[model samples]
Target: MIAPLMKQAGRFSETTVDGEVVLLNLDDGAFFSLTGTAAEIWALIDGARNREAVIAELAARHNADHAAVAADLDPFLADLQARGFLAGA
Candidate 1:
């Protein structure tokens, strides 16, 4: 099944802290601090990419196995979806 789009009403803002980016959810006052691989994956979640494309691109960029990346990404994506930071396109 395709992932659903992030809610339109949710507000997301990002800032760099000590050379790392942190994404914030203004509505609920939640924050996600991204670093290393998680940060890389988070950066790919524009509104234009599908799940498969994201997996492939991230795999190539990180020099990681596709299945492994997908495995790690599934829950992260789910959490972002749950938190309104990412929307499927």
Candidate 2:
């Protein structure tokens, strides 16, 4: 089966400021901000790339190990999912 694509939640209003992604959740009236590598990861989840593809790109961009980046990526993505920042695919 094909890997699921990652996407931002529709309830969020997002903007990039100084290289960071700022997300406002209209449902909860809360603001979330992602910077540094987190911003990069957030930017990559555009409903087109799968998780592994994102990890690979991040690994190459940081010159880090694929396994290591994948390790780090899981929890960040999970947290985003838990917080309802990600849309179901």
Candidate 3:
């Protein structure tokens, strides 16, 4: 089983305007922009969900295969982790 995600490590707040996604960091003023599939995946990382669950949800939502979703998810998750937007499991 996949481990649970840590929500308390950081906080995320997002806003969409004119088809663009702006994700804000609650701890600091730092923010990032996401587009295309990155935006879709970003919306699914609620921090309450595990890596496996996020991939499963994305696969179902986008009608994609699990392996494909997992492959795409790794780098995105790594970016978020590196940016302090997501915590380690």
Candidate 1: worst-modelled 10 consecutive residues by lDDT? 1-10
Residue 12 in candidate 2, Cα distance off native in Å? 0.5
TM-score: which is higher, 1 or 3?
Answer: 1
For residues 1-89, write the lDDT of model 2, one tens digit per residue.
55665665577788999998998887898899999999988878877788888888998898999999988998988888867788653
Q: Estimate each model's TM-score.
A: 0.77, 0.88, 0.72
Please report, in order, the local distance difference test score of every candidate based on alpha carbons. 0.74, 0.83, 0.77
Rank the candidate models, highest TM-score first.
Answer: 2, 1, 3
Candidate with top TM-score is 2
Candidate 3 deviates by what RMSD? 2.7
Give the per-residue lDDT of model 3 (tens digit) for 41-61: 766767568889988888998
- Candidate 3 weakest ten by summed lDDT: 1-10
**Candidate 1 lDDT, tens digit per residue, 57-83?**
989987989999889888988887777
Query: Could you tell me the TM-score of candidate 2?
Result: 0.88
Total clashing pairs for each candidate: 0, 0, 0
Q: How many angstroms is residue 30 displaced in model 1 relative to the true structure, after the best TM-score fit? A: 1.8
**Candidate 2 off by > 4 Å:** none
